[model samples]
Target: MFIEPDYKYMPTTTGISLPSPKGSRFVASCIALTCVLCFVLPSGYSYGSALLCLTCIPLLLWFRPALSLTREDLWILSALVFYVIAHFVIIQYHGSASRYFEEPSRFLLGIFVFLAVIGFKPSERSWWLGLAIGTILGGMVALWQLLQTDLPRAQGFMNAIQFGNLCLLMGCMCLAGLGWAHQQACPRRWVWLLILAAVMGLAASFFSGARGGWVALPFLLGLLYLCFRHRMQRRFLLIGLTLMTALVVTLYLIPQTGVQLRIEQMSSGLGGYMQGTHVDQSIGVRLEMWRAALAVASEKPWMGWGETGYVEPLVQLISDAASRTQVAELDHLHNDILDTLVKRGALGVIALLAVYLMPLIVFARVSLRASPEDYRLRAFSLCGLLLVTGVIMFGFTQAFLRHNSGVTLFAFFMVVLWGYVRLAEPKVHSE
Candidate 1:
């Protein structure tokens, strides 16, 4: 019901200046509230995002917010369509048909959230500010968990790995917010608060002993360097780097922390797996699972084993009852690439690639052409790239997309940023 705008048109200013309907702000506030709940609720908050998405459909239908699509959007949308179709194919192949009704609904809800962002054009500052606050609160909860437990790892609200991954993402967003604040020459205390929030989020990840997020940190830092080196003064960069190094060194020196021990275990496990002597530990089990996945994939290279098909075959390949049990319990292959290859086959791989890479290409391109004044977009592009990097890295040891949090976070941010990018038009004077 909304009027269509030129594909390339967007607001030139930092935020959109549309004359939204009287009730649009109310709906926007509801979305914001959902975001806060998503952050504060330790577990099952992905459903909160889904709920937000469901609400968007009726709002979009009633208000008819402006909508535009770009080439990148088309690529992403096409991938989603193909993925849904692939599930239908799986049903034809007599795979688990119930999954068709289950998982895709979450993704479809994500699509609604995407459309709602474009249509509503909610306040950028409010959205991000609320997210920042929620992130800080989440980080505090993680710290509290660490203090309350005698366990080696702390996972507040979610599992250790997911919590760690979330902290890393929140850390990245804080860095981008810091950069945006600096660009605007905001008060020093405001910048300090952003830095504090980033530090706390990162520290929580370390406390959680989540190796997956740590694996992505180097690349994340590199991205930040590239994003900030040209934008800020040299002294600030040097100071930030020094402080980061000091923090790492401090964490390393702490005797109670399991980071060093975990690294040693990973190395030993990998070495034993390579030497063909041990196949019982964590890393060893992952290797075994991967090997079995590869075999299953080769057998059904084109269309894959379907939702429920891969399990029994993989279990048969594993000789040890314990190992077989472990394999059976795993919902999907730990690796996203492998899981897609097994379930959706080669076509699913292409679709999955499209979903991940299209955003990278689109955001990177937008960032390159962005002027110094476009701090909001620049920060957002970097945040998107960093978030995607973290998720992909996490996927190496886990089926990230198979998880609700993974689906919700990735889809929500992608849409939020792209929606604004679409709405960003060169400022036009009214006659």
Candidate 2:
């Protein structure tokens, strides 16, 4: 579907250089488009990523070897490609049509986007500001949804869980941006602006009432602390925690936000789960799903049952009819590990683990370059770490990779964040 543009040689022929000033700016706009529209509109984030991915074809054909791509980045691209191939093999083994190809295929396509970002080296400012602006606008959309409709959750254009989790993740990226913003001309104003974006993003998350997303909060705070502990003062940490506590309490007290009701619902579910009474509920159903997944996987260890093949056994394994019915109605197991383990076994385990771990490793290694003076590199590294950590933690309660939005956001954001960190510090990738 991509036409080879006639202007492919324009940057080279006109006394221009690779990674020219104009090229950087153009790439910056492309990144900005990706972040700014990430959650504000329906699948809007993909627009920019599509352009970036499309750019990869020509780059691969023409400039593959001379490019500045590093060994570590290729590690990530290879892992993503492996995921797609692994999933495709699973599909072929199951004899299913390519109906299940979309999700993992996202990771494959993301490799192209990663190549484009690395080759072009998009503006880091564009990345952070675009993230903040997108979260701000997305929060507004969620607010409008809350006030104008009777829906219990403000999902915007996505499922409430995906919408809320992504908003929270981008907001965390805004928090990570503070490190870089300090070096800017208007540091104080930019700091406050990023803080506001963070608040708005959290607000949107609360409004969506996505309790599964809430599971990642402690892990989020932990990662933030690890990344910023040396950079941030103890008082600032205390103050931030105090403010967060106050914010959660305030949101809980507000009836329209549905925060309190959601908490109460979870509490009741847990209590009923303890007494073995409400087997039909969300928490109970998830527990049953996990148990069923484990049971089925034990029967076929290497490559477990196919998607459709596992359901009958899953239903048979569950004792509660209500829980069985609930589980049967769904495609995923509501847990990423269990779903992957039950369906694709060793191949999937490797792919899923790589999808989470390679980026984590790459960012962790790159973040080591954040010396006291280099806040820009530090900021991008922290953002990448925080984003991946959020995805990993969020997967515990949701089969996040099962959703198109989840796959799109994770794949594109990983590349953009990693690319920015590497571009900002050229030596980080080599080290």
TM-score winner = 2
- The per-model lDDT (C-alpha) reads 0.70, 0.80
- Which pairs of residues collide in model 1? 10-423, 10-424, 10-425, 11-423, 11-424, 11-425, 42-157
- Per-residue lDDT over 193-309 for candidate 1, one digit per residue giving the tens place of the 0 to 100 score: 778878877877787788778888888889899988987899999999999988877776775666667777888989987987567777888889899889999999888888778
TM-score: model 2 vs. ground truth: 0.92
Residue 134, model 1, lDDT: 57
- Expressed as tens digits, the lDDT of each residue in 201-285 for candidate 2 is 8889999988877778778778888888888899998998898889989999999899999889888888898798997888888
Runs off by more than 4 Å, candidate 2: 1-16, 19-22, 59-66, 426-431
TM-score of each: 0.87, 0.92
